[model samples]
Target: PQHAGISLLRVLLGFAVGAGAGLALGAAMGLSRRVDDHVRPLFTAIAQVPALAWIPLAMLLLGIGETLKIVVIAKAAFVPVAMNTSAGIANVPRALVEVGETFRFSPLQMLRHVVLPGAVPPIFTGLRYGLTHAWIALVSVELLASSEGLGYLLVWGRQMFWLDTVLVAMIVIGIIGFASDKLLAAVEARLQRWRTDGV
Candidate 1:
């Protein structure tokens, strides 16, 4: 139970940090065409590297500590969210944008009233992806370096030849990931209701 509670807290914290950074970067990528053109290639290249590849560097820079874990999880989360958000915003209907402009809407107003709502579905999709990625990365990081959390439990179990504990940790990770996915799916459905209701 103690391990379970700590693992749960770590997952929640990882999600919070990862999601916040991902949203900020994603929003920036989505909103700015110039920024997108400038940074997209770099972002793509960086993302192509495996998440575990960064673990050693993170350890070197941040040491075997909480920061390293958080940073890794955040990096894992950021890529998908940013990529998806950019695509979603860029794909927003030009017709709606034009309509907003015709009504003399300021850029901010246009974004808030027209672009945001149109982009929300994809944004949520990105967020869901980010969360999933973060969870995976969190487990990996914990397994590699951490002394606590569920990932640690798995590693410790393996070291002790305790298959039952390892199995339990794996199951718990799957359950949490599934729950997060479902929660995001529900939110996405709610946001997308306008599509069918014609709002």
Candidate 2:
């Protein structure tokens, strides 16, 4: 559980920063054509770069610290959330916007009443994908930089030829990832219920 806790903390911290940034950026881009026009190309280019690709440069900069791990994991979590959020907002029905406009809703009012509620589903989808990505990245970074973690266990087991250790760690990682996914899914379901019931 110690090893598992380390991995979970790493994932949560990194994913929170990445997903928060993604949500903010995506909201701005979705709300304003100018922001999208300027940012989308850069976002697209960075999105194409794999999370692992940043490790060497990050190591050079941060020198194998926890900050490097967080940055690497954040990179992994950012793209899907941003893209999904942008798509979600863009896909908010035009009719709803028209109604909001007809009602003379202020910008904030329109966002609160129409855009956010519509965008939330896709944002949650993004969170799911981001969690998965963060999990993958955490293990990857841990394999390289950590002395003790499930990923490090995989590495150590391989070196010691302890196949059972490797297998057990792999199983633990899988179970944790699966459980986290289900937790997020349940939260999403509850949010959907709240929206449906107008809570």
Q: Highest TM-score, which number? A: 2
TM values, all candidates: 0.91, 0.94
**Candidate 2: count of backbone clashes, pairs at least 3 residues apart or interchain:** 0
Task: Encode model 1's per-residue lDDT on 140-181: one tens digit a residue.
Answer: 898888888899999899999999999999998888889989
The 10-residue segment with the lowest total lDDT in model 1: 3-12
Q: Assess candidate 2 and give its lDDT.
A: 0.90
Candidate 1 at residue 88, lDDT? 81
Q: Which stretches of candidate 2 lie over 4 Å from their true place?
A: 194-199
Clashing pairs in 2: none
Reference-based lDDT, residue 1, model 1? 71
- lDDT for residue 86 in candidate 2, whole number 0-100: 90
